[model samples]
Target: MIITFITAPILGRLLHPSDFGLIATSAPIIGFVTMIQNLGLTQAIIQRRTITKGQTNTLFWLSLLLSLTFATGLFVLAPSLARYFQEPRLIAVIWVGAALTVVSVIGEQPMALLTRNLRFRLLAVIDIIGIIVGAALGVAIAWYTRSYWALLVPLACTRFLNLIVAAFAARWFPGRPVWDEAARQMIGFGAGLSMFNILNFLARSADNLMIAKAHGSVALGFYDRAYRLMLLPLTQATWPLSRIMTPILSRLQGDPEEYRITYISSVSLLMLAVQPGLLCAVIYSDATVALLLGSKWAEAAPMFACLGFAGLHQTFTSTTGWLFISQGRMRDLSIVGLVSSTSTIASFAVGLPWGPLGVAVSYVISDYALRLPFIWYMTGRAGYVGVGDIYRTVGPHACGLLMSASALVLIKASLHAPSLIELGGILAVTYAINSAILIMFRSKRRLILQVLKVACRSVMLHRTSRKGRF
Candidate 1:
């Protein structure tokens, strides 16, 4: 995340909007294909409590075979995809992406093993190294080529590095596949998850697809960048939490009350971490765009604000998957996916002709007015989590965000900051004040302090151990 944040702006300046759009156009297709390629077996491996060497070996071979097939298919279909997106360069861009799928296959089983064993620190190190290396490569490529391929080659290289790192870190070797009843059961579970992933991807990408088709590449470029900016911080934060929580929750599955408590606490902490930042984005979209991507991207500011609002609900609701997968509720999760995908698609269609901002605004409206409420009701029905519980968990953060927004509005109305830096400072002060108010609440205060203590101790221990080793 740090690497990307530091380098993305430089890449943005080097590359054109069309360059971003061209790559963005291919993402939905690649995402949909990768879902099929993995067939959700990775999640299956992580969710399962016990597995034999033979069972894992079988899944590993299955993953490799599927990945090879998908890579070939994607490569063959590159021309058609390029034609559809109407960008000839996409043929090369997509071929590179296909190579990434192949690279990912090498790490699939290793990643699952590492996750199952809860070696997250090692996983984090592997990922950080991959991302850092990839970011550097991407910036260099953009500097030299100034082409859409610059966006793709880095991803492929990153996957390749990640595969090598994860294999070494996992310390696991694959044996020959044994196709038996155990493999069948795991594949059956994964098939259900695969379907859910497909629907989920469609739900997430429908807007991108629609924007690309209706608004054209340049328009899509603006929307895509806005969407990327909105999602990056939220995803960087929540995705890691999801990785940690899924296994932990799966381990606690037998204890229903503990599961509920864990979910509520985990999600509450997520909201506390993300909502204020999103609100800050919402209140200061123009400055964010100016500072992050330059004034050339001011056109995306409104869309970014809308997506920022949607990201809040998305951040809260994304944890639903952790709960569902942890509990082996794939069928239930699939149903939720169906409803979510359908509603989101319909919303995208309704907003299509109006352009990118319209699509973004509609998405936010649909999330609040339809999708989130329905999801809360559905996920809560199992008695482990109640809709009231979700409301209670997120309510304080929502209140804090509202207060922060209100304060920001008053500040903007009363004073002109004269520059983006001063404006940022003013917003920072507003957030600090709001944070202090929230900390006045004893429970939030305790949670914040506990988190700080844990973080500090971890850093200190890491330093002490390094010194001892040296």
Candidate 2:
């Protein structure tokens, strides 16, 4: 996540916001194809209590076949995707990007095997390295070629690499698959996860598509960049918790108590990290854009504010939704997503009125409205969490964020920063200071202090060692 945040801004600057937007246009296509490849098998494996070599082989072969089929189909439909996106040139990029789906399908289930066993560190490394590689490829290619294709040039490479690395790391060569009723049973569960993912993608990407359709690519570019930059800090921080906890939840699948406790604790941790991020981003919107994306991207600032709050809903809801998967209750998730999709469509409909900004506001309101209730209702089955715990984890953060936003408003009320760079620097500093104070006063203050102390000592030790007993 750290590498992603650092690399992404630099990469965004090196590339054009339109580069991001162009890719955004293809998001639905890529997302749809990726969803097809998953077909619920990966989730099924994670939820499965026991799996032998024979079962794993069956899942692998089925997944590989799906990957090949989906990739070919995507490439074939590239022109249709280009037509849908209204970008003629996107056909080639779509075709190339489709290959990633092929690679991912081939690699995904093997990765799921690792998740099934709780081998997360390896998973983290794979995720971080793949992102870093892809982002670096984006930067380098965008710098040299200066075309939209640069966005995907690294993607295909990274997917291929991730597939190879994950397979080798797992050391589980897939043999011929045996047809088993058990395998088919897993698919029923996987189908539910697949439904949630497919619709969820539509829900999440609604903003970008709405912007592009209502406005234009250029306008979409600005909004997309703002959304990405604004949500970066919170997403980076909380994403790991989900990535780690989901499989951990899967391991504790039968045990509702553990699942609920883990979910609530993780949500609390998310609040601790994310609360201040929302406040600070709203306060320093322009500064963030200028510092991270250069002055050319100042238009993305307000939209960033919209996404900053929207991110809170996404982060928490995604975590809470894991219970459905862990508890093997995919149907409930599918229904929740169906209801939430209405909110998404409604948000886009509202976008028609406000343009990009309006769309963003509608998105936040609808997202929170659905997620607030959905998270509680889904997790209610497990005793460790309930509707009130959601309020508990969320309310303080709201208070703290409100206080920080108030302070920030007072601080910057008299000053209108003329330059993007200045605004960015101000935000960078204010957010830093505010974030530190916020965390320092959170429930984890003592633990943070201890970690900071340990880090300081380690840095000192390393420096002393380097200076030869200085």
Best-performing candidate as measured by lDDT: 1
**Least well predicted 10-residue stretch by lDDT in candidate 1:** 415-424
Can you give the TM-score per candidate against the true fold? 0.94, 0.86
List lDDT for all candidates, in order.
0.83, 0.73
lDDT of 2 by residue, 90-109 (tens): 88777777777877777876
Give the lDDT of residue 263 in candidate 2.
73
Give me the displacement of residue 64 in model 2, in angstroms.
2.7
Against the true structure, candidate 2 has what lDDT?
A: 0.73
List, residue by residue over 99-142, the lDDT tens digit for candidate 1: 77877877888888999999999888877877777788888889
lDDT (0-100) at residue 463 of candidate 1? 100
Best by TM-score: 1
Instruction: List clash counts for every candidate, in order.
Output: 0, 3
TM-score of 2: 0.86
Model 1 clash tally, residue pairs: 0
What lDDT does candidate 2 reach at residue 247?
73
